[model samples]
Target: MSPENNPSSGIVSQLESWAKRNINPLFSKDTWITLGEYIGLGRPVSNRPITTARELGSFVSSRSSHVAQSALYGYLKTRAGTRFPELFENPKMLASINLAKWHIYIACISDLAAYMGVLLHLRTGSDNDKVVRLMSRVVDDIVDEIGMPDEAGDDFHESVEALKIRIENMDFSMHEDGDAVFSVSPDALYKWSPIADELKRFDRTPVKNSVRFRWKDVRETARNLFDAQAVIESFGEPGSSGSA
Candidate 1:
């Protein structure tokens, strides 16, 4: 589609509108349900919390199209989580669970859309052109102010790698190769995971005393630890609902 012919314009526009309405520090659950209510499927969400995956699942089950449920969960999930702190702080853990469920939900819908040829990129390792392109684009917009990756420097890639190795190395069982140990690694140690290795193994740039580390700098990077496709595949396929 041409730049002017964006198919997601309507849906994407609606999403953007939701973002504007729920600007940080002043979110309202009632307003958040605008899109889901528009779809007229999920449970009636109010200013109250939609606490469990079961609740999320029940809401998902009551929906019609998988796409509809996916999209609704997208909004609910976005609003409910602390995944992006700038957007939502120390949010209840349930929100994070739901957000994860939402991501899984939509990723599955996107895959289905691609499977039916309605959307492409339904399968793994394919270019974003397949299915995630629109999503990746929309997600970029959705999380732009929350955590704009564009603003960061090239320093991210390696920093991110170090983080992943730490996450992966934590517990020899997790070693994709079943070959190491590290553990939760949190956010900091993960980034520092490689300092020792890099310093010892390669001629690395010395750490400047002035360089400050921030989670925003590391959060996106930490996300790189998991095999994204594998994450998607876990929730993919039609019958594979968000439960369990």
Candidate 2:
């Protein structure tokens, strides 16, 4: 059966559709103003929108990781009582769970970098050379902003480089529909899974399956969220400075 008709795929598609629609509101200046007010950051005196590549990078760095983590947590919590009943009972497995979280976090970052690379290319009308350089700067900003550990940081960089090469070779003409139509291939998704080592070492089948199964959904959701933010950043309100 086609993905749209399949039960599992339908649910995921619905969620993605909902998320894409809602993400626009989340990037609104008024949303940030209310967030700032609630968080005691105080209302900003100005609208500091994300315009430059570095700014977009920093924005993704701050937001993507958290979104990834939350996605994993929600997935696990949803499955804890059914597919992985042991998750709640086995406190000893917490370390493995945390490891999986970080692994997925880095992988999601890599995926987002590739998607953002494409977005930059299409939106800015930049060539591959400029796209790669801007993407590298974005990655650097993310790594520095997150203060990732040395080992994980290295892995993150390597993963991003590999994906960037794949993106560079892709037929971007397919993206005329815009960022929403862009998607990483299943092969690329499989290759990018960071949990293989964890799965081998932990012997926790439930956690392993959980990580693998939910990965594609998580990556797609992150892309949608980032695309929403990128839209606003690439072309702000009608008369704003960032608009095309």
Error of 2 at 49 (Å): 2.3
Tens digits of per-residue lDDT, candidate 2, 13-69, equal 443454365543223333333322222232122224555555566555544454445
lDDT of 2 at 117: 64
lDDT of 1 by residue, 1-244 (tens): 8745743444445544656665455344443344434344333433222232222222222221233333333343443453322333334433433333333333322222222111112223444332233333222222232232432234434433443333223222111211011111122222322223434233222121111121122222223332334333333233444331
TM-score of each: 0.20, 0.47
Off by over 4 Å in 1: 2-5, 16-151, 167-171, 174-244
Q: Which pairs, if any, clash in model 2?
A: none
Give, for candidate 2, the lowest lDDT window spanning 10 residues. Answer: 38-47
lDDT for model 1 comes to 0.31
Report the number of the highest-lDDT candidate: 2
Counting clashing residue pairs in each candidate, in order, gives: 10, 0
